[model samples]
Target: MNMHKLVKVLAPAGIAATVVTSAHVASGDDGINTVEAAESTSSNYKYQGDTGYGDGNFLLNEALIKTLEEDGDLAFNGHTIEASEDDYETRADKKSEFVEEHDQKFTLRDGTATKVVFPIQDETLSIDDVTEAYGDDFETTESKNGKYETYVYKLGDKKDDDKKNIIAFKVEDGYVTQGTIGYSKSY
Candidate 1:
């Protein structure tokens, strides 16, 4: 297995810049495959090896959202899908919006959840804890002011396709404050 690491600096005002590191593994000559760190291909995302969180599934796509709705685990927060007047080319082109319920914030694109943010609220959550829960194969960014930090773990090969899946942690004061799991068309 070969590990690749890339570092980048982004200077956004008041926000932390990023240092991204990713690992790629090659199959051995014996035909045995070594596990690559921080890779998840399933539609349902997980944190700490569990899928359920906060009265519903934490990170879900369109199909899983529908299933949760049917199972009474999720519901719309009374906000209807409305497209902007000029950008309404088609139903599929509508802008993504957030629907909050069950203490989870779901970003819906075309009535499907593309991203979900949930509260961590664990004062003991640390960077090492996040690394253990997910993996060390992640990209990290810290605030310019040194008060905030974020770690992003890739779910799939972003270089190979347009679809992006990731798990992210937002830390403040040396502790993780929140988490997010989602997918996007591009990152």
Candidate 2:
């Protein structure tokens, strides 16, 4: 499922729902997929595991994190890639070459790109749309190293008080659509 569909199916943004208390699902063969988003941590959040790009494995820079502190916890709004006709069945099979693509960027609260092209998958989003939404205030990255094509964007506050969240999409031209949200308290 693409990030767009994941956001809607798992975490519906309606009537002000709070952070998830707990959940356990059983995905049939497709892998038990769950979208973790929406709720702010009741306690301080912490950053774990390196983003693989840096110490925290996070893609955002020091300056950008500082900026989000001035605003509310950052939330990412994505796009909708309609799956073919009214039935959601894709007529065209997804091309494997899509992995060779890449893009990345960094933006501020007002939505401006300060950096771009680190190459992460935005199957749930388009780089252009992100550029417009984040402008020149944030940073982005892209890469085709994984089994699946991937593009990404990263943003948030200081590592000690993380308020930023990540929204991502998984693209596979034909079979299914999905999304994933990664969050941290950033201590």
Each prediction's whole-model lDDT (CA):
0.42, 0.29
Error of 2 at 72 (Å): 13
Candidate 2 structure quality by residue, lDDT tens digits, 1-187: 3333333464444522333322112233566444443343431211211121222112222212322333332222221112112111121233211111112222221222111112233243343443444345533232355444323323444353223434443334421122233321110
Off by over 4 Å in 1: 1-92, 157-164, 183-187
Candidate 1 clashes between residue pairs 3 or more apart in a chain or in different chains: none
TM-score of each: 0.47, 0.26
* Stretches of candidate 2 exceeding 4 Å from the true structure: 10-30, 42-125, 138-187
Cα lDDT tens digits for candidate 1, 131-182: 6545577777876787788876654333532233455677787667676655
| Best by the TM-score measure | 1
